[model samples]
Target: MSFISIKNVWKYYDDNLVLERLNLDVEQGEFVSMVGASGCGKSTFLNMLLGRELPTKGTIVLDGETLKDEPNADRGIVFQKYSVFPHLTVLQNVMIADEFSSAKVLGWTFGNNKKLIKEKALEFIQAVGLTPAVAKYPHELSGGMQQRLAIAQALMKAPKVLLLDEPFGALDPGIRNDMHELIHDVWQKNKLTIFMVTHDIKEGFELGSRLWVFDKLRDDPQAPNAYGAQVTFDLPLAERVNKNNVNEIIEKVSRN
Candidate 1:
């Protein structure tokens, strides 16, 4: 069985159907990217995987068990907006994640293990190339640096699946490229399963080992929602890594 299985899922808002019979399977240690225009149910799908939103129909299973209604350590999410606490230092941000984990396993007094928690937080911060910024607050860092901190915080939890929702969307091109390289390196080092939603076709091809495209048509009023969408294509990561093949896939998605 796949590490993650999303079987025949459907989502609706009031009477509007956002997703119809959507199904996906992600293997262990795979990097998959979901690419489509805005409001095509990309984020909706990620939320379902994270168990933040339940499907109106069908099931989402991970590691042979159904997901709970609340978030868990098994899944970590990084969003376009920085979720760092403004009042906390970089070290504090990551250490707090450890504390949360410890609290779940131990008790609420995880803050007492200051030395051990600090060491773990520093380890993840250094892994993400943010050693020097550990003492700084979120406001003191650049946009890219803040995003890196977010990534570090997420990784500190050692989640089974990492969900990135347009993490580099707000960064400049140069910084975005650098962040992409960093993410690729992290994925290789940890062999973590990753799922990202992106609108940039180039970035999707660059980072994804497998790509899923969603095409939505608005012209059909008879459709359940304003957006009548379909899962148009699925391709291997190797094909996308090649420049020519990447362009071909981009063209194909564009035409859809």
Candidate 2:
């Protein structure tokens, strides 16, 4: 069985259909990159995987069971915008993730528990190369540094799946390249199943083991929302294949 199964899924907000017939199976440790035009429901699909949203018609299964209709520590997400606490230091921001999981009511830990969480947070901070800014608040950090902090916070949960919604979209070209390397290292070191939505086709090809293109197979001009988008292409980025056809894949993704 697949590690994550999305079978015959469809999403709707009222009468506006968003996704139609999204059937795909994702294996563990596979880095799947999603690309498509804006408003094509890429983020919505990621939300379903994270359990923040439910399919209006179908179901999403994770680890052999149906996914719950709520967010949990099993899945972590980092958005394009920094999802950090502005009031907290870098260390505190990462530590709070564990606190929320361990001490739900208080959202804080004490004594040995606090010490362990702090140590773990520090480890992740270092892994993301943010140890220098451990004491700085979000407002004091650069865009790339803030995003790194966000990545550290997500990894603090040790999630089975990592969902990234254009996590590097806001960074400068140099900073974005650095982030790409960092994420690649993190994914390999942790053996994480990652689904990233990217507008950059080149980034998608460079980072993902597999690529998915979401596009509308049918369109009704009279009623735009009458039909929704689906997976128009699924490409496996094998080393040789990717090296040989990078431009071809980019062209295909860009045409839609």
Candidate 3:
């Protein structure tokens, strides 16, 4: 069975319809890069996947179970903006996940549990190239460093799925390239299933084994919000392709 499944999914916010007719099946360990025009329900889809938002209709299933209408350790998310605790050191930020799981009542772990959490946090921090700054606060780190810290924090739970919403969109070109390499390494090493939403078409093709384009197929000039976005294009990127084919896909996305 597919690791994750979306069947006839639709989302609405009161009178506004945001997404409609989404049906997909994804296997474990697949990296799916999602692209769409602004306000085309890309972030909304990610939120649904994260369990922060429930579908107004239909259902999302993960690991053969229907998704609960709340976030859980099975999934982790990183956004474009840095999501870090300003007062918490890098190590502490990552350790919080373990602490929450181990010491829910106290909000902190002690003794041998604390030691083990610290060691595990250190390993993840090192994995994201943040070991040297383990003692630093979020404000002390640069944007890229902060993002790396966020990724490390998210991975602390050892989630089966990772959701990235424009995680590298704010970085400089060089820093973005570095982050790309870092994320690729992290995904491969962890054998994670990743769903990333990006505006960069080239980055989508470069990083994902599969790509999805979301767009509204039906439009109403009289009532603009009457219709909603859907997955207009789905492509497999595992095969080698020349520049022309890539350009064609780019054009197709742009035209819609």
**Per-residue lDDT over 14-64 for candidate 3, one digit per residue giving the tens place of the 0 to 100 score:** 878999999999999999999999999999999999998999999999999
Error of 2 at 60 (Å): 0.6
Query: Which clashing pairs does model 3 show?
Result: none
Clashes of each: 1, 0, 0
Clash list (residue pairs), candidate 1: 209-237
Find the number of clashing residue pairs for candidate 1.
Answer: 1
> How high a TM-score does candidate 2 get?
0.97
Work out the TM-score per prediction.
0.93, 0.97, 0.97
Worst 10 residues of 2 by lDDT: 237-246
Weakest 10 consecutive residues, lDDT, candidate 3? 235-244
Q: Candidate 2: which stretches are off by over 4 Å? A: none
Over 34-139, each residue of candidate 2 has an lDDT whose tens digit, in order, gives 9999999999999899898989988898898899889998999999999999999999999997898789999999999999999999999999999999999999
Residue-level lDDT tens digits of model 1 in 1-256? 9999988887888888788777778899989888987888889988988988998888999999998779988999999999999999999888887776667765334445877888888988998889999999999999999999998989888999999999999999999989999999989898999999999978878898998888764457565475545577877777447676667768878888
Model 1, position 119: C-alpha lDDT score? 86
TM-score of 3: 0.97
Model 1 misplaced regions, further than 4 Å: 103-112, 217-219, 222-228
lDDT of 1: 0.86
